[model samples]
Target: MTETLADFRRRVADFLAHHGCPAGAAPSRSRRPADHVAAARVHQRALADAGLAGITWPVEVGGLGLGPEYRQAFAEESAGFETFSAVFTIGLGMCGPVLLALGTADQRSRYLPPLLRADEVWCQLFSEPGAGSDLAGLTTTAVPDDDGGWRIRGQKVWTTYAHHSDRALLLARTDPGKAKHRGITMFVLDMTAPGVTVRPLRQATGDAEFNEVFLDDVRVGPDDVVGAVDEGWRAATLMLMNERVALADNPIGSPVTLDAVVALANRTGRTTDPVVRKAVADAYVAQQQAELFARRIAGEVRVGRDPGALASIGKLAAGRLATQVSALALEVAGPDAVAWDPADPDGGLWAYGELYAPSLSIAGGTEQIQRTVLGERVLGLPREPQADRDVPFRELRRG
Candidate 1:
């Protein structure tokens, strides 16, 4: 018999409580990739044991075989507590979905179960130094070998959690002669392989949450390929759409930050200051709007409908909202928001958020690209002018 939402929630809550998961504390952040992965693995194991992880995944793949509403409810409730699920966001939110959609039956059987249980963590290996916005212009190459495997050589930057990941979903060009988007293929790479190396990247906040990966002659078997060889562009597009949706739909987990800002205003007696009040109110409104927009898109996706251009709307909205809220946070905090001290009692969390806000606009896709997409696809505007539409990538001038 299927369990109701209420019963599921109660069971999850009880399981968490019984397992000594703390309640009502600030979410944990780790600078060490090993610590982050260890914590995430533990949490995922607990959730899987209790049938809470991968609630919407197929039961044969170590999931509960539930619907998206259940998944949404579980996420919402899980947001109420402090957890390390965010550490595995790329795996659970993006890679897993892509695998489910594009993976072969053997691939799914070999990968999905462990992923659902967090036995192996995954990272996205898509964006390159030259291919952030024009991802199709990526230079990563994969060549077929006599041994029935492919040799890959590439560099992927801004790869989140790569330093800790067990695997990567990699994109590379298999046929340079084909159109930019038509020559690509996606493969699941083992990060522990001898040809793979990951270097941590230090952010402004002094945390190495991101990494740069180098793939030097990394070999992958034919079974590692996801979807059709040349059809990977479509699969990648699907993964990216899901990524934008997930990012936009991320639940606000820092209510304490919001409360802290409000309390600071009240304590400083600046609640009546027109500028301060307006800033605070505006931040709140943006958050609410982002939440609503994300919820609507998620609901549509849950019902088996493609969100299409509305996914771009959500990504654009999230980028704007994150920037706005970070600015508001800094404005409210005044001088304290300049430099963060880890040892400081408040831990300078607001300052960190402020520093990290700019990445949101660039990470999944650039704000400019998203705007062009929305305008052309959603608003029925003319497509952006491209002078090199018919030119070969090799002949195109490097700007």
Candidate 2:
């Protein structure tokens, strides 16, 4: 008999408990990026072998061929523990599903298993310095090469784990004469190609979790295209939708939770203080509301509905909750939050959370972008006027 979702969850919890969770801080302290990536690969490989890594994926692609509920079960089980899932975030959450949605059979067969097993890692090349939330403005170009392949040129910024990735899902302008959002193409490119460069970008938390990637004459074959040429906007839109879904479901509200904040207040003897108490209560309410939004998005996904507008709205709510929780954590921790005792093991997490909280607004999509999406898509409001929406990309003026 096949294992049910509950049994699968129990088995996953047991394996993780027995084998030990991903080291609480191994990646941050690793001397080399390769070492950190290797550790993550090993843990992910173990998860895949245990039938827990790609619960919602087809069995032919190194998954259990289970439904989304099984994936949800695993997610719920794993949320309470530390896991080195950061390295696989793009591949599993966005790229893998996108491939499932638009990739040819050969591409899916060739890439999915290795990614699910963590033998290879992937990064997204979407945003550029000039076009983050407004990703359609990206100017990276992919021109036809002599060998019937594409030669890429330009830079990508804020790419997570690009420095350690083996492949990248790239978006580039294929026909600049078309409108900005049109004439774009998405392709899978080898990160190890001769002209590809990955440079780490350090964050406010002092961790180089993201990178700037430069591609010059990087070649990818016609077979590498993910969707119909010049129709990559559809693929990109789907990936961004998944990105919001993944980020929305993250339980770490600004890397801290209401329970943690409440516990901190109690430990600091501030729980009885009216101000702190009220903050905690309000935070609990906010987090709960955000969670409801997340659940609604998740339910849509589970039932084969596109998150659509809910992705934007849910992401905004989650970002706000995360921001609020981060503030509440700092208030509860008081002086100890910013500067921590070196001796305490959790000293870094609090400081890191405080520093990283601000990024929730920027990642996935900015708050303003989310609100705009909600206004236009969900509320049926007219889109704000744009000066260049219909102009040819090459004709648009840029700084």
Candidate 3:
């Protein structure tokens, strides 16, 4: 007999309790980056062992092969518990889906199982110094080697969790003779390769969660290519759309809750302040709107409907809400948001949230890019004028 949703929820709840944390418990935010990675792997392994991970993916790729309703049920049941799956966000959210959609059968058989179990962490290596917003203009080059493989030489910046990742999904120019977006190819790169270097970029939060990766004559077998050569733009676009959808939940796991901020306002004696009260109310409403928008998109996708560019709407809304909520938290905390006692980890969390808030608007495509996508694709607006739209990558002038 098929299991009911209530039974599935109870099973998940029992697993979560036995695994590490119980429901309504907060995630440990003060752990070091490496510690977080270790905990994520352990928790993800437990979920995989319990058959709770990859709820909607194919069973052939180490998933449960269940419908999207099961996935949604799992999300609802696990809402309050701390799963520590954020470390695997890029792998499961973006890379794994792209591989399933455009990868070879062998590639899926080799990569997806370890990914589902967190046996190997993955990151995205698409952004470069010159191509943050204009990803298609990336100058990274991957040339065919004499050994029927490829040699990649380029740099990627703003790579999340790269230092802890075992693999990465890379985009590089395979044919500079073609137009900027035409000659690209996607590859699965081993992060521990001989010519790969990862340097962490310290954020204002005093953490090195992001990195700059340098590749020099990195060798990749022909089988590592994700999709057709000189046609990576299509694969990249799909990955990006998936990324925006993933960002709707704020996968970084630091959600700014209204209750927590309200408690802060009461503690700081700002509850009576009209200005602060109004701002808090506005932030709360925005948060609810963002959540509803995300749920709407998720509902459409769950039923096998294509949200298309509508995915960008949720991402844009959530990013802005993050910034607004964090700023309001700062107002509520007053001076405490800027300077907190070093011994108290919880005291510094809101401060950290404020610092991390700006990145939400920047990552997974910038706010401006999201607007442009919505404008052109969803609103049927005219395309932005680009003089070099048809120019070959090599012919375009570089700064």
Steric clash count of candidate 2: 1
Q: In angstroms, how far off is 42's CA in candidate 3?
A: 0.3
Give lDDT tens digits, candidate 3, residues 1-399.
557878888888788678855533434434466766787788899899998888878989999787767877777777767656566668998899999999999999999999999999999999999998888999999999988799999999999899999999999999999999999999999999999999999877687888999999999999999899989999998897777555543345345666788888887788888999899889888878877878888777666566788877776776788788888888888788888888885777687777777877777778898899889988999997887888888899876
lDDT of 2 by residue, 1-399 (tens): 668777887898897786646535455532345677787888888887776778778878787878777767776777655566566668888899999989999999999999988888999999999888778998999999877789999999999888788888999999999999898999999999999989999889777878999998888998999989999999998898777666544533465677777878777798678898788889888878877778877777766567777677766776788778888888888889888778986786667777777887778778888888888888999978897798999999875
Give the Cα lDDT of each candidate.
0.78, 0.81, 0.83
* Cα lDDT tens digits for candidate 1, 1-399: 899989998887787676635544423464445765676688788888887888888887777889777876766666656566567668987899899989989988899999988899899999999888888888889999997689999898989888888988999989877778888999999999989989989886677878889989998998899999977799899888777556544632332345667887787677888998888888888778877888888777766567887777777776777777777777877877776566886657677777766766776777888888888898999976886575666666655
Reference-based TM-score of each model: 0.91, 0.90, 0.93
Task: Please tell me which predicted candidate would have the highest lDDT against the true structure.
Answer: 3
Q: Worst 10-residue stretch by lDDT in candidate 3?
A: 22-31
Candidate 3 stretches greater than 4 Å from native: 1-7, 20-31, 249-255
